[model samples]
Target: MKLAAATPAAAQVKADELGQIPVLMYHRIMVKPQQSLDRSTTELYDELTRLAKDGYVPITAAQFVSGRIDVPAGKHPVVLTFDDSTPGHFGLDAQGNPKPDTAVGVIERVAHENPGFRPVATFYLNKDLFGMDELQAAAGLKWLVQHGYEVANHTMSHPDLSHLTKDQVHKEISGMEDEIVKMTGAHTTTFAYPFGVAPHKPAWAEKLDGSYAFQGIFLAGWRPSVSPFDGKFDRWAIDRVRSEGKVKEDDCKQFCSTAWLDYLDKHPDERYTSDGDPNTVTFPNVLEDRLAKPYRAWARVY
Candidate 1:
């Protein structure tokens, strides 16, 4: 027998549209345990399975920043972001399908097993482009974009911009932009800080007139990000929780993906829940003040 739906969105689900969203940051997907940040193929699969069981759907970082969190009623939006264009993150097998051990591969597998778990993610790239040759790199990027995945700029070299001159910062970012366009023909609208920190002048990496502009800049932090429609949301320095189990560093016991996800599971009201209607933002009437002024016209208070 089916239990009754919780809250009231179409008499079907929870609709706290103003709640926090988990923007998970990943680094590498390798076989065997190597480091705290490294996750094996099975580990990746298990984590995603947990999310699917918890009524979460994957969306690209670009979509999150642009206020395009379109999902089913009662489903929460989660951004699965991978940094550094490593082969472990994406690659193809002899059959032209995503290799089963890569990040994309695991995502596809999980999505296949769990209905409505979109097999899409945002990958931040350095100039190496999966350490592949020019032709292979181009093919990989083309495949990702042709699908629903987002490919965004990291930099020419994943350098610490805080130590470089203003010109150097511009070169590092613009160089990757030029290369991305040259290879995949898709312009990136988002950026991830090389080390979760910005350039000394910040502006050098934020935008460049007519050449490069970003809808959002992400940081390697540990926390659920507020909705882009929230009045206090900061697109320039968006937070991303590292996709890892608990650790001693950075209060990971209370803040890493595992801890955060557990918290969200226990406290559903604090996380973003869709109203099944993409055109309008819906939430509890008490959160009306939290909605940004620009998004007022689309607001639906319950």
Candidate 2:
């Protein structure tokens, strides 16, 4: 399969047209029966409602890859993403790992209640994280893919790609792509760099070659729309904005803060560039410093 670059149309489109597609990264939406994110179902529903009222569109992987984020195309075009292949997503087992039944239950309920707003989620997983049965993995994959969801790569063993050799990185990246395609019959192009580390900054690594064979649908690292082609490294880097727990109503008052959105829209060259420069000075230096520190904090764990 031929991997292609993002369309020139995307670049020409105004920030008003593209808007702020906040890719919200989440993991284990539902915790083990006894263990949870200290949040209740009512609370989760409220958060979703609040986001909806704020004009956030929970876009799907397919919609995102296709650049179809136009409806309710306001200031916020948030993408809801889930990481890890935990069975607890299905529900927890006796050992507290995810159970297929539990996880699918949460997804099914969400799908049922949302009607036309079927929230599409991406599952980045290790091949071995599923059940012992290979057929089960294949079947489970087919089930999710057939639904409105997409499965992308999370590496073979979930190692820090920045620290590994180029060949080793290729193995981890391509091996998982091969596995997903073999199981689901679709070309797997996206990859979440194991722990959000790029071969730059404190990760202290060099950039790797862009995949000539795989077309990445989405990945992690760069902020929305920024690419590595210009001067920055890792075009595969697709940055996500994270929302932790429930913030006060006042805290998120401008949840879809028009001012911030307006600034981004006006300064599209800084944030959403196809020119290939990932590191552009856009936000205030102090705030940028604050944001950069967290991403670094996030990458070190892997």
Candidate 3:
């Protein structure tokens, strides 16, 4: 419903009515989930299709934080968030059309097919991890923003915010914020914590908020606003149920399976809003799978 951010009435209604808004998180959208891949292409589409069929509205991170888009009484509102700027996300066609798998593609298709459902997406990108080179990446970033996606920060290098030194943390957050603003002319206010870690102290969270709009975190699960430890300040710190698997056949079923919902219900603590001075946490580098298709060659730098 295009909610205004500071309206007291809207905020109150959002708190009272919206049940746990399931924020669904995803990585790449490939037919095959890389060895380390959590979800295959079929699974991604299947989950989306089911969400459409089930009368789910895909709200952007902005809507989630603004408390707009009233959740129909007793309805579950969901936010679709994708992380990392991966090349594979630029979906290729049989004839070699370069269709980006950016959340825009998904939103547009959903809007077209489901007229009642308005689809918006939050794209969390690491300044250093873009699949394309500088210029192309800038173009791509601009395109995503132009098309109505909220480009939030994942950090300069997708490092664990809790692990870096305070200086490193500033670089990670401010550096990406500056790059994004320069490239797209959009001030990135929202940030997704690299690895979900509860802020050990309150100042860590305060520092982020003071630095930028710092809207929310996309961690795993379903959280209602009222519960203590509800992680609401992290309310901007939202939770997403992971959707990884093949979407075709039973894979789609698996993506939205009852089991997953049960899992989210059971693990409320896993949802992290902040940990203090995250720079103290050291993170290990892990390799994510890169696509090997010949079509990917088109995206290669000469």
Whose lDDT is greatest here? 1
Candidate 2 Cα misplacement greater than 4 A, ranges: 1-15, 32-46, 70-76, 91-104, 130-132, 199-235, 246-302
Candidate closest to the true structure, highest TM-score: 1
lDDT of each: 0.89, 0.47, 0.52
Per-model C-alpha RMSD = 4.3, 11.4, 15.3
**What would you estimate as the lDDT of candidate 3?**
0.52
Task: Give the TM-score of each candidate.
Answer: 0.95, 0.59, 0.66
Clashes of each: 0, 15, 24
Residue 251 of model 3: what lDDT? 45
Overlapping backbone residue pairs in candidate 3 total 24
Deviation in angstroms for 189 in model 1? 1.1
Q: Model 3, 249: alpha-carbon shift in Å? A: 20
Residue 49 of candidate 1: its Cα lDDT?
A: 97
For model 1, residues 56-87, the per-residue Cα lDDT tens digits are 99999999998978999889999999999988
Candidate 2 lDDT, tens digit per residue, 1-302?
A: 21223234332332222123556554554432343322334434545555555444555554554443444312345566656666543333456333434444454555456554445567777767454367667877876777667677777787876677767776676677678878988865455655666533322222235431433434442234432222332334556644344244323322323333434456643443221122221222222322333133211100
Ranking by lDDT, best first?
1, 3, 2
